[model samples]
Target: MAPDDERLLKLLTTAIVNHPRATMKDLAVLAGVSKATLNRHYGTRANLEYQLEAHAKGVLAQITRTAELHSAEPLHALQYLIKEHLTHRDMLALLLFENRPKTPPLENEESYAKDLDAFFLRGQHLGVFRIDISAAAFTELFINLVYGMVDAERRGRAASSRSASTLVQIFLHGSVASAASNLPE
Candidate 1:
């Protein structure tokens, strides 16, 4: 993407994170652009939302790349991802809570889902993760825990309750192999 587009995406994401149901005009104002510019760029609310979802998928892909989730040992990758998600609490809020899953990814974005599925399957095969849950559910639970911690911290609802280590502990204890499940921390 061009630098201009990237800038717009960042501004728009921040706007949405701050006000999820903002009108196009509201978004433009929050994004520091005019309504005309927003219209010229996005054409419609649907288009804007589609772009945001794509951006979220792009962020997730970036996280996976940084974690080397496919190439690294699954346990390490999982731990890195849990910590990374905490480090990216705003992104998690945008992805998990603020953005409703109304738009499907474009054709090019489908591989992210496939890659995560394959990685979790690898973990299960290696006995790093539990076999009882489907890969999709396992992934969902992990994300939900991260979201909970992020949300709690964002709201200033808890101090010690919202640490990434706590999330990692709770998530790993439930998701990992029975013996290793005792090993969250």
Candidate 2:
């Protein structure tokens, strides 16, 4: 990212994370730039949102790719991705709500969805993930569960890593495998 772009993104992200109702003017002030400068850089709120969405997708892709390169199994890789997301809850929450008004198609978005599908396929082939469910469905399930946990944490309802981990374990066993009873104790 260019220096100016980086600065703008930092300001916008911080504002979104810190103040849920942040506006462009708030971002401009936080970024220490004039509104004209912000408009010149981003063109409009829609344009800025598009850029933020793309940036978030790129970040998620990089996280999934890194996990794929290092982890021995698909589930382990997913766990790593979840852990990383949990560690950056503020940023993740901001990204989740950004550009949502004009949501992009899944294929057009650069998120980890495709990589996750591939990962699920691999797990299914390895007998780790059930073949009954479609990859897209599985991906959605994982996302919903993870997002729920994040929401719970944000609301101070869930406060521990153990709670998050347990949620993941339950999710993996219940949805991915054919029988939860078959899972390791």
TM per candidate comes to 0.73, 0.72
Q: Per-residue alpha-carbon lDDT of model 2 for 19-106, expressed as tens digits?
A: 6566778777876888888898887777776676666666666677777723358767767877876765655666665445865654
Worst 10 residues of 2 by lDDT: 102-111
Candidate 2 residue pairs that clash: none
lDDT by residue (tens digit), candidate 1, 1-185: 99889888878987887798999999999999999999999999888877777876787778877787778999788888877767666666777776455665565356666667778988998898889889988777776777788788877875643486777677776446676756747
Ten-residue segment with the worst summed lDDT in candidate 1? Answer: 99-108
- In model 1, the Cα lDDT at residue 7 comes to 83
How does model 2 score by TM-score?
Answer: 0.72
